[model samples]
Target: MKTYTRITLSLLTILSLSACKNEEITPNRGKVKFETVSISSKLAGRIEKIYVQEGQLVKQGDTLALIDIPEVNAKLIQAEGAITSAQGQLDMAFNGATSEQLSQIDGQLNAAKAQMDFAQESFNRLQNMFQDSLVSQQQFDEVKMKLSMAKAQVSGLQAKRDEVTKGTRFEQIEQAKGQLDRAQGAKQEVLLAADERYVIAPTDMSIETISLEEGELLTPGYALFNGYKTNGVYFRFTIPESRIYDYNVGNTLTIMNPYTKDETQAKIIAIKQLAQYADITSTSPLYELSESIYELKVVPTSDISGQKFFNNATVLIKK
Candidate 1:
């Protein structure tokens, strides 16, 4: 019995020392990660249709949803009207007065000239009477006033005729051109707003959520969570500042999946220090509370095609 007890004690002691040595030899730990993107609408409106479901893999430029904005429709109509009106104004500026308008001005000028001729003859007769004392001074003065008024009317009509014959002013033409450009620009803006009503994917990503259902109001800039891109897979390691010297950019190392024990070669792509306010979990919390933490990014150089890994999955760095 004493011999059996001694042998058991020795075996236990050897196992305890081996466990400590294995623990010391363990490699740095990291997590698998991928780039995530958010999807959203730039305009506020009711969601009319949803083309994708949660967890659906989508390609770049795919239409995800449709929105109905009453304001945008109204603005489009208004823009069309404005464009028509502006075009008419520009044509008028370029083509000058119409034929009917010129004809009317000419008729008025002819009538005014006839009336002025009659008034001039009457004024001449009245002047003769006043000089010969054939009538009262007040009577002659009234006739003179009539003649003056008729002459002024004829001059005004002649000026109108001349203006009608002349083409549009240069300043007026420029003003019309400006108005036309403004209307066209407004129409383009409306067209862009119409395009925004159709939600399109900006990049290749997996749909993580469908936040709003059909017929629900979607506010401008509201986010619908989209998952990480599959091809942009990488790993992130939160290492203590003291151990950062062991890794650097462009260093190739082998990384292993903790559960599957599958290994892949990855190259260090980037190393950045975490923000001062950022909180990170390390393999061991033996460092000071105020000690800085760093994030090491690595990308697989070997073909990881057959291997399946999820974002934030545990991975170990092999020295």
Candidate 2:
């Protein structure tokens, strides 16, 4: 019995020593995550030609597709013709009447003046004869009527000649010029429309998805392709809300790959204020907790030219 008690006490002492020497195990750290952005089109039309293929890389302003432009080109041609005609009309209005036209008006004015003079002479002769009792009152009245008709004809001719000599008025010339300008502007608009038929890349990005095919009709604001920058690849991670005040923009941090234990450096690019919430009953381990968090965007110092990390890649971040 004494031997049994000694053995039990010895085992208890060994268990106590082992428990004191054991170290606490640390919990595994989690990575940050972010939502992705998809790019879409601003204008829609039939896809005439595609300049890029699946998984192709493109730079900003690079032509990605060429839409049919026959209609727009035709309109542009029509606008050009209109502009030319309007310009010719404007020029004609600004220039005065030709020398031949002025000469014709002058000839009419001279003829009118001659007729008036002849009528005046005849009237005076009849008036004197009547006073000397050499002509009847009826003859004097006829001469006076002929003189009045001649004066009216002279006045009409003078007014007509003035109008022809004046050519176009300043306001008329200005109106023609305005029409020409409008035609020119229309031509420019048609040209711009034609240019818009060809869609180009907005930035140096990779083709994430292609939603349309050649000959497909698309409307404005349609999604034709999705793209993202290849070199600007970033990783987003969230820190606890309690640590939100510890970071700011342009702050530097170290990042590690949770799976491979590889380490890389990064910087804080932005922080979101809204709290992300998830249902407690949800099975998604990613959003098990509903709490406010600080979003951190970290970009690699070197170009991630050919690397494609998986979405929601687990990473370790350290200040």
Candidate 3:
């Protein structure tokens, strides 16, 4: 009975020692991560339709959603009308007055000259009568005023004809050109706003969340889509200050998926102290309260293009 008791005690001792050894060699826990991104609109509009759903993978330039901005359409129409009016004004400046306008000015000038000749003749006759005492002072003054008015009218018509013959001034033409350019620039801006109605994917990414549904109003600068870049996978580990010296930036290490037992090579790209307790990414509280925690950012050394990594998934660092 003593011999059997000794053997049983020896077996228990070996098992206990083995279990302790396994615990001591356990790998450091970490998490798989990816760089996140948010897509937003530059202008406010109602969501007309969503082309992609959550968890859908999208390529660069893909239309993710369509927005209904009725104001944009109206503004575009206004821009077009402004452009047309500006163009017409510019053409008029370049072409100047038509032949018909010049002929009309000439006809008016001829009529004004005929009236001036008649007024001058009457003024001369009144002057002679006044000298002979045949006309009163008031009558002579009235005839003199008529002659002066006729002369002024002839001078105004002559000046107008000269202006029309000279055509538009250089300054006027330049002003019209500027107006046309301004109108064209406004139209370009409106077209750009129109393009904003279609929300496009800036890069290849996986959609993680949609902030609004179809028919919902989205305000300017509001993030409509939250997603992750397709090739932004990495690993994050929180290490207490006591064990931080074991890892350094640029050091190569083996990372493993705890559930799948899959392994990959990675390099420690960064090591920074955590500013807050919430910043720690470790699954379990494996450090003391008084100890400072640090984070390790690791990037895969080998091509991980074919591997799938989920955000916040459990990953381990192999020693």
Candidate 4:
């Protein structure tokens, strides 16, 4: 019995030492994570339709949802009307008064010349009568005033006709052109706003969450969809200051999925100091709480397109 006890004690001691050695060689735990994204619109509207669901894979430029912004349609109509009015004004400036307008001015000038001729004849007759003592001084002066007023009228009409003959000024045409340009720019803005009504996927991604349901109001700058980039898988590990020297940026390492035993080669892309303990994603961290923690960002060295990855899943690194 004593011999058996001694042998069992020796075997237990060897097993204990082996367990300790394995513990000493264990590496820091890492977690798999993907690059996250949030998508929102610049204009506010009600959700009209949703084309994607959570966990759906989407392509770039795919329509994810439709927002009903009635105001955008109304504004578009207003912009079109403004463009029409501006175009009409610009055309008028470029093409001055029509032929009918010029003809009316000519007719008025001719009528004024006829009246002036009649007045001149009457004034001459009155002047001769006064010299022969047949007409009074008051009558001669009145006839002379009438002739002077008729000549002034003819001159004013001639000046008006000359002004009509001259087309619009350079400044007027420029002003009209500016108005048309402004209207065109406004219409373009409206068109862009209209496009905003359709929520589009900015890139290929996997939809993770939808913030609102159909018929819900989505405000400007509010995140409508939260997702992950399809090809942005990465690994993260938090190590203490004591172990940070074991890893460096650009160092190649092997990462294993603890659950599936799948392994992949990755390169350390960054080493950053963790400012907060809450940022640690390691499982069962054994480092002292007082020790400064650092993060290791690792990316796959080769293509990971065929591998399946999950966010915050457990992975391991062997030093």
By the lDDT metric, which is better: model 2 or model 4? 4
Which lDDT tens digits does candidate 1 get at residues 107-155? Answer: 8888888988998899899899889999899999888898899889989
- A best-first ranking of the candidates according to their lDDT comes to 3, 4, 1, 2
Report the lDDT tens digits of candidate 2 across residue range 129-175. Answer: 99999999899999999999999998998887787577788887898
lDDT of 3 at 242: 85
**lDDT tens digits, residues 39-126, model 3?**
9999999999999999999999999999999999899899999999999999999998899999999999999999999999999999
Poorest 10 consecutive residues by lDDT, candidate 3: 279-288
Q: What TM-scores do the predictions have? A: 0.77, 0.66, 0.78, 0.76
Q: lDDT at 180 for candidate 1? A: 91
* Cα RMSD of predicted structure 2: 8.1
Q: Best lDDT goes to which candidate?
A: 3
Model 1: weakest 10-residue lDDT segment is: 278-287
Residue ranges of candidate 1 with Cα displaced over 4 Å = 1-26, 114-157, 275-290
Note the Cα lDDT for every prediction shown.
0.86, 0.75, 0.91, 0.90
